[model samples]
Target: MIASRKQWRCKVNSCRHTFSVTSGTIFANHKLPIQTYLYAIALFVNAVKGISALQMARDLNIEYKSAYVLLHKIRKALLEQREFTTFSGEVDIDGTYIHPAPRKANKKIDRIDYRLKENQNPEKRCILVAREHYTAEEKAKNPLYRGAKSTQVVTFGETQSTVKHFADKFVERGTRINTDESHAYDVLYAILRFMHGKSQGRIP
Candidate 1:
């Protein structure tokens, strides 16, 4: 069979790395030809009952272990493909806590425990998420940001600089940003307004 291998190149200007289809993948060490591996994975994903390595091996006439490994590899790629990038338009910013249980060891009898137990709580990092439809003007002005747009992840912290960085990266300068009256965002509106001044856009 004619093996057709996909190739990928690093886009970073500082680094140049050319790799085959199996690069940075679970299949990198497999001895099977690239074409066969791709076909097996496609069939496995399409299987109605959810294909197992043993089933794939029986169907594709390959080793059971190889089929299992390939399935896991595809699963990783599926996850990485679903990562969130940015947001636009009337965006909503909010934070939710994901508290991890506090850990404590056995205390010695009558020993003075002087550790900051409250500070040791694994504070869940903040999350910012938003989504909006793509407009004609936005697509024209920022072509790179245009697409069948979906959700976005926002930044954290109570500093203007942090908010400014998030605004620059996700929110276009002139778009209306809908957020609560958290003191952290007091200057966010003004900073975004300043950035919009340079572009003639208004905070909606």
Candidate 2:
């Protein structure tokens, strides 16, 4: 039986089912042409500052809804294909809050205190990111090795609990972790001490 590149059948006698190259994957049942998908990916990757759905639509000459869905599909595929690995050597961590602010009340007396955490916008979410730097050996071996070797991002509420959890799960013990002055990372102090003691055989 001849196997076509786009569509093929199983060689087995009992399981001669037919399938295509994009079967059982994120690109399955794609509406856009293969070249368009490739071009979209190129635009997405080349966008250092990031590209919006509207921007992608204009660049790719596609509808706004199509561009938005395609962009989200790419993001979902990346998250689904993640290879979980702990960061070692040196790791940098930071967080930032992002959300569209809600409209205020018409009168001054109706305004609420936005500064207080309790009254702050509930839609706001903090985006936490951790990047692992390449080891000395890696830098020496690879001539074009950039600073960050790998990056992990978390959108689940950023706080002391979340930061600690991320470090414990993603970071390797005895590795140096760098973070900003945000209190969210303050938990790392105790975590570092525990790891250091455990490595030195001081902690049971």
> Candidate 1, residue 200: CA error in Å?
31
lDDT per residue as tens, model 1, 131-152: 5555777778888874454443
Which residue pairs clash within candidate 1?
128-154
TM-score of each: 0.39, 0.77
RMSD, every candidate, angstroms: 12.0, 7.3
Ten-residue region with minimum lDDT total, candidate 2: 190-199
lDDT by candidate, in order shown: 0.60, 0.76
lDDT for residue 182 in candidate 2, whole number 0-100: 55
In angstroms, the error of model 1 at 144 is 25
TM-score of 2: 0.77
